[model samples]
Target: MIERKITYQHSFIGQQFIAKLDFTSQYHSLYCARLKSLKYRCISADESGYFSLSEIMEVKVNQSCLIAGIIVCTYADRSSIVEKYISKIGILADRKQSTFYNRRKEEDFIYLEDESGRVRLDLKQYFDWENLITGLVVAVRGVMRENSVLEVIEIFYPSADPPRPLLRKGDEFICFISGIEIGNPSLDPILLNLLSNFLQGNLGNDSAEVAKNIVRFVILGNSLYKADKENSFEQKAYSDISADIVPSISKSLEFFDTFLAELAGILPVDLIPGEMDPSNSSMPQQPLNPYLFPLASRYSALRSFPNPYECKIDGIHILCTSGQNINAIMQFIDTQDPIKILELTMKWRHLAPNAPDALGCIPMQDDDPFIVEDLPNLYVVGGMPNYQKLVTEEGVHCITIPKFTSRQQVVLVNRFTMESETLSFVSVIQGMNNC
Candidate 1:
């Protein structure tokens, strides 16, 4: 087979040299340029050893530059690129120059020799040669200068490495109430109305309050569902009647007897049997009457800004610093108001154990002081839930109020946290109505 010789001028010294080339068409169209003495240098390694030197000449084409005069050597039968040359003349005469160096070896280096008689060239330091060699091979565009030795004057490494990708943030998850079971008779109507309003998106100013009420409603509903399941007729009957008719009927009187008996052990006073006289009724039965019980008997000075008549009867306030105490309070509330007959509000504080203060004072004439502590705040009232912790930095404490019945309780519950922010509550209520 006939061997081809690749010829190019030794631009470094303005001389001509011929290489017995085994060129691959696969690498055709690559550009090349002459590199001066030390203008650009590369540190490369092969099986023999590692070395560093400047690029003397480059084969320039429209598309890419081919690094020429690279000597290839073979060991046994395996072919590889050669790093060291006994003399410059031998490199120009080598046949397998491309495959002479150990391309896999990290210590191998390729050196470019410039021919004599070329213009003297100014070059960067040896250390910068690494970047220059890579810059040329990657086809980076830069300035060129002709001196005593031909060289790449300016070079870049546009394709020397791969690019990186960007990152993004993650999403968060939250849970909400969907439904509840009603067990407590007093809480039923209020809770029903509240839920109705909530589903309708009419729970104004009371998102949290309504949430609390929903919790209470859920608890009571669960209780009633359980009672109904257990066939607890007496318990079921007590919760079945409306607030107005309940207080006036003989059946209510009997149910109250049983209820007081059931509550005798925990209650402060014995449940007393009262006469069912309509004429003596202090309050008339309204569809919304169930919601008024907590306000009338339990909450003190319970008043809305535009309307002061809002109150929750048979409500309970809970306070505690420890989760255990909070759980205890919730358990107590759950048992006492099984039907969730009371409104519940919870507040958490970092302070040592102390009694909870009234959120507001009830009017003297309308107040039922006996149940003041049991008015508005109910389950998990005074302390953070087991899952929640107190944050002392801003002296910020959390309060949760569950209105077992009234949708308005949602507004009131939120009021516990956001004192005067009427818009949030109003918007929520409006949204509920729209929904």
Candidate 2:
């Protein structure tokens, strides 16, 4: 095998999200930071200059003006921990709907708010209600009606940063594997072994050549799934329940560690925790404890990163998440297209805009880490239903990787060319059998 000649490096914003938690920080601070970060970009994107922006308080009634603020959605059924607690006090709390999207569309209200105040947005004509959601920072040009509602005429989103030119050209490849679900009893051992063998160059000659160029591998969340069914209604002693849970969790982690060690032995592997993973149930989930992977931890090629991770590989900035942010966004939007959802987040210039509202997020007082201060060259969201990829006009490679356990496939991207393709273990073996 020829020596792989390519430069690779990465730095993470993990520390920004890892600080000691102080419950005093209000969730509003996150919106404030988002507004401050992207407001100028929205203003600059409005090249027509049809209306100049003003503070919500400064807008004159019936006069055309632009205002930048965070979106807030109000509805009787919107997700709220306070309301949920209140509902739990009732007899039927558990029967409540898990999602607020089922509420009648007419009952929903939209508001644009800043430090001064919030105004209802009369967007019935200009925008699709399902496309907009709470917590997005945007600039809207419109006239403030006498009824204290803003009749919007135009909307402006933050401009995307241009992708930097590719620094080099080669066969350099990076593999993205998501939703491994290692501990699931339904997982196919055959497929698992095939994936390992293919990656380790133990397959055919062509497979060996391809695997040799793989510079790195990324495991994007759901590495471990709760395979055991919990009997929610069955009564048990607290100590007994804890005792049963510990063994199950330990067993799952053991399997994940072994699985990861195999891949890390072949190439550097970066692991991001997911919704099912045993990490904090909040946005910017911290990395899984290295101690959990005693075997894999011994390998220098193994790295555990937080959800919504960022780094630059070979000068191409990559922004990735374990699919929680995207999944959260799906609850509010009408479409299921992952690429379109990703594009919406790109336009808003914020990741997980619905954080702390529809989803759990640590209250960040200093800055909104979700804000995309700079657009990255590669944007990846893992654990989608299927693999999807699109290179935006701005040259951002937006990719959604499907769960490997289900698809029996993983996404392979040419680092230098920004070209992407899915490599399926099952199909390769079938092809080999046919030959």
Best by lDDT: 2
**Model 2 misplacement above 4 A:** 1-6, 13-15, 76-83, 86-90, 93-99, 102-104, 227-243, 428-435
lDDT of 1 at 120: 23
RMSD of 1: 37.5
lDDT of 2 by residue, 232-316 (tens): 2211222334455677678878877887888877678898988778777677888888999999999988998888878887578
Residue 139 shift from truth in candidate 1, angstroms: 69
Q: Over the stretch 1-435, how does candidate 1's per-residue lDDT look in tens digits?
A: 111121211111101111112223322111122122112321121111222232334422222222222211112322223422323235444233311223354443323333311222223423333211111221112223432232433322211111111122212101111112233444433344443444333554544333322211111111122222332211222344356544334443343233323222221110110011111111111111223223232332111110011222222122111112222223212133211211112111111011111011111222121121211221222112111122222222233323222322321222123121111223344565698
TM-score of each: 0.18, 0.90
- Model 2 gets an lDDT of 0.79
lDDT of each: 0.23, 0.79
TM-score, structure 2 vs. true? 0.90
